[model samples]
Target: MDTNGMDRRQFIKVSAAATAAATAGVEGILAARQAPAFAQGTALGMLRWNDFVPASDELLKKTIIPEAEKALGAKITLETVNANDIQPRVTAAVQSKSGPDMIMTLNNWPQLYEESVVDVSDVAEELAKKQGGIYEQSRAVAQSGKKWLAVPWAIVGLTIAYRKSLFEEVGYSKFPETWEQYRDAGKKLKAKGFPIGQTLGHTFGDAPAFSYPYLWSWGGKEVEKDGKKVVLSSKETLESVKFMVAFWKEAHDEGGLAWDDSNNNRAFLSGTICATLNGASIYIESLRKPDQYKTAKGAQMRTDIAHAALPKGPAGQFAFHVPFSHMVMGYSKNQKAAKELLRYLGSKEVFDKWFVSQKGFAVGPTRDWEKHALWKEDAVMLPFKDAARLGRAPGYAGPAGKKAAEVLTKYIITDMYAKAVQGMSAEDAVKWAHGEIQKIYG
Candidate 1:
């Protein structure tokens, strides 16, 4: 908790400019000098969710685009489109080869643009070499067969949010540290008519946050590297799944099984449930936006609620982050310009605005930003920060990974996994889900 390492934003300015300059000096400026000939203005057709971090044009000009253009020597213009409907536009644009110069979003976009998208592998490697390894969990996401697609969009930020005053009302000066203690606290909350809002609906929100940490704490894993073979089905994973299902009925609302990711956020915001699960940033932003939080019974909060990392599971405490990064197109007319842009974006100086998002600072999945000036010495970050240390991203990165999640959600969402969780017999639920994947995937 020290204002130690470079305030990530400051580091970005100095690092990005310096790195861009070095590229010009070391690689020569042919691309820099040539980009303007083909591209006349800074016009980029971009698509993304509504509230993306670094989504502002001000940040784009100061933090991202300036450094990138300085190095690439071409002007870029950005066009924004709503994510809910942008897929079709992006598809048409890219297929027609008239898409924006750059596009940003989750790495798991349906149809990847290896040709249109810039490959930022070099940028990612540069960051890793400069920083003491850019967190393996995230690095894994950037790399594709030795080619890198992304650099982290700042730091991984999946963290828990909780009601602070609620903890105090429960007669505890502090919250419990271990899983057992957490369950006991839940019992206490139930005694007070504030039981946790449980779920089985959506994987991106409560389902994933609630499950992956369970696996990490128990030392469970979704896959194992067996020499050249990637093994998906494993005992550790089975145990983790079974354990997660056990909480489906206990922790969720009566309609929890039919809920989706947004359900938890709505549940918590509405105060229908004392605590649910969600991302650290979303939780913070929710507190700031009254519109984002509504009552379970449809009332809105007159005051802000609080959030922290969910309590540790039986295995151990852990966090779940969406490890995101940027990648470049292999077939770009401006490969050199694209790569330079990639380097500039990854440079700490260029991406600093991401840390100052209305939500909270995003550091390495585990690095503590609580002590930083940006956080202003806020202690509420402690638990969330602690959760980051051992957290895991749900396997949503690769094609196989996405398919796997779909498979799980399809079967598990309907209380299928609940049977196993409730001790209705693990072999059936476990084997059904696992065997189904093996057949389809194999």
Candidate 2:
């Protein structure tokens, strides 16, 4: 995958460090790896994200479930849960060694529960070979310590969604293509009474999506390349902090300090802001509900809104592409049925149907799957066509494991930027973040 544009200042440094640290751990683990063969069972169970797009869940129930059951000669039951509840539910299930046979989760969670999850390297390899090749960033998140603990499912592409009319009103025919220009344009928009919005609160999705890309654009990283040392105290990071503080004052509202994942979506749709960084969900919502917008009905959203890959920085353009994954638990008695169900769903035919049902919001994991017609048909989605390749896991300068997950879950990086923007000194904020990160890595 071509994640060449995903890093600003320290791509080489972060990649090298994380690779060395992760490779050693993987080698030792794989040397002792042992896995059971596929033995079909009578039934299967999967825990999945409750569909934000209702049609998606409805279609899955009507199509994939019946097809998989028929193909595997087993009844597969799926339990849909909210995104926030997934970690606690999965953790409890893993602890009890009695729960669903498989589960869907965001980010590199399989790394955190590797010991309790069955190795699905076979399933992953089969899909990879069949699909030409899986994305490099996807592999990084799914593999850990030499085990394919989870199968790479899809990339939830993140990009900039903005009001085209608003930008053009300020002499910008298109969204700015660089950080400096983006900030300047934002300032202009702010003066025009429509500030750009970015959440600074502890939102799991939008918070990291915006903050990490900004940090990377400034050449700042959470940790050193070895994935052990905290590096947020560097000059590059301070520059990012200063930029964020000024940008927040001029471009964002105070309410953003407490906004959650849905806040920006609502804000953008309500005509409260000129732009925001988000997944296709925000843009999709605009199209799905043109009545909510200030523009007249019909082609209002399609004509007024557009997307851009995150603007380039002095280091280069960067963005966060979070990989969603699916895994089977080792303790499940129905592991064979679960694997069969995964295989059935992994087929291009099954996934393509689900992808369209969601209006192409779900990204295909590999390059070959790009043959789906969605990218060609929608201009808003075209920027995300290579998202699986041009994005990074949140744990950029570190291994995607328990420690990195902890830092992210606790909102360490988000809090750091939030504090700085809220008037905390840049040095003090970095110090606080460094201290917090040290507790995790150490």
Candidate 3:
């Protein structure tokens, strides 16, 4: 919803003269205006990241398959194939035409898989028709040259979480507005001898979420203009890296580098960090536990935390947002049936069961559904809903975006960010990183 605080420097430097994001946005809008409804059919086959387990099998038995049967007189049988990697899962499925009819994709996956997946623009058109005004950022995700490749299912938005009791104890008057203010708040707390604890580890999916906000907020663009290049090495990128290193030193404990995905949870719960980087799911978990927040396990004993928009930098504030992009593949035996399944999943009835009843497996990237009874009092998910309003997908979009981030992870971001938090200058680590990305993307 809010594309605020995006880094525009590296993108400017690397400009082919046209920005990929801007163009992508334009194309998607245009498609939404013109795409026709695809015809519906019968029982469709599906392939998902989770072939037989949590991401897929569990989803089908509990939500999708039953919903589809009810909506389209269709039954979906799933095929399990381990994606060579996330990017390949969609592309190879489209290119080879050997898998199931539908796919469960990451929000940005459609960009790369568009060439092979079915034209999903109509699904989104239906969403807009249903909601009056669809969340615009979601349009960015579904856009390709002339069609939408994915349907938004779930959103993972980020927010700042800090201990309210700690802030009160530190004599803080109010929450910080921009990232700088937030940083200063952390500094003040540290000055008072309370360490703001956080983690920077080689943990699952942490580095990108922790730092992407800064890069984006610093105004860094993932690709150069002219829609033809990547900007992982631009000045905006350099500055973003610089900011993280500074933030890490100032806010994180000395052992922050040793922290893992569960570290922030453990630390904030233990009152180790004054404020921590976390998601709505944390609060949701807390609410479910109830006593954890009230007892030695409660939000106070656990961390009487509150959520804030990620802090703003000199350029702009930022945070990582992950959205689930769902789609039916081109090879689905039941093409129309697959589309019907998609439609049913996005409807009011199924959404309740999938998102709330099943606990966010079918997520909403936009807050249009915020009024749903489930999220209103969801102590944790409500903030996530707020964060979703400001969320943005990965910089590397579609095939190129997904593929490049992979390169960034294998070559730069993963171990590089891990090491940078350990005292390496981010620039130095990224020097090796940018070089690594060049080799892979080029």
TM-score versus the correct structure, for each prediction: 0.71, 0.88, 0.72
Q: For candidate 2, lDDT tens digit of each residue in 1-442? A: 2475445544454444334323432221223231112233476788988866778898888877876565444668888998888889998998898898999978766777878888898778878887878887678878886678888888878788898888898889978988778888889988877898888897767888788888888888878767887787789888888888888887777688899878888888877788988787877776777666655333466568788888877677777777788999988997755765676577776777888876656687888867777777887777777766677766677776777778878889899989998789989998899899888888
Provide the clashing-pair count of each candidate structure. Answer: 33, 3, 28
Give the per-residue lDDT of model 3 (tens digit) for 384-439. Answer: 55566565545443233545445534525545555676677777877776776656
lDDT of 3 at 118: 78
Error of 2 at 327 (Å): 1.4
RMSD of 2: 12.5
Give the per-residue lDDT digits (tens) of candidate 1, residues 199-277: 6554444565565565556565434432112233456556656655544444435566677655666667656566666
Off by over 4 Å in 1: 1-43, 52-98, 107-118, 168-173, 203-206, 227-246, 286-307, 358-361, 364-372, 383-388, 393-425
Q: Which should have the higher TM-score, number 2 or number 3?
A: 2
How would you order the candidates by lDDT, starting with the best? 2, 3, 1
Error of 1 at 28 (Å): 12
Greater lDDT among 1 and 3 belongs to 3
Q: What alpha-carbon RMSD in Å does predicted model 3 have with respect to the real structure?
A: 13.4
RMSD of each: 9.1, 12.5, 13.4
Backbone clashes, candidate 1: 33
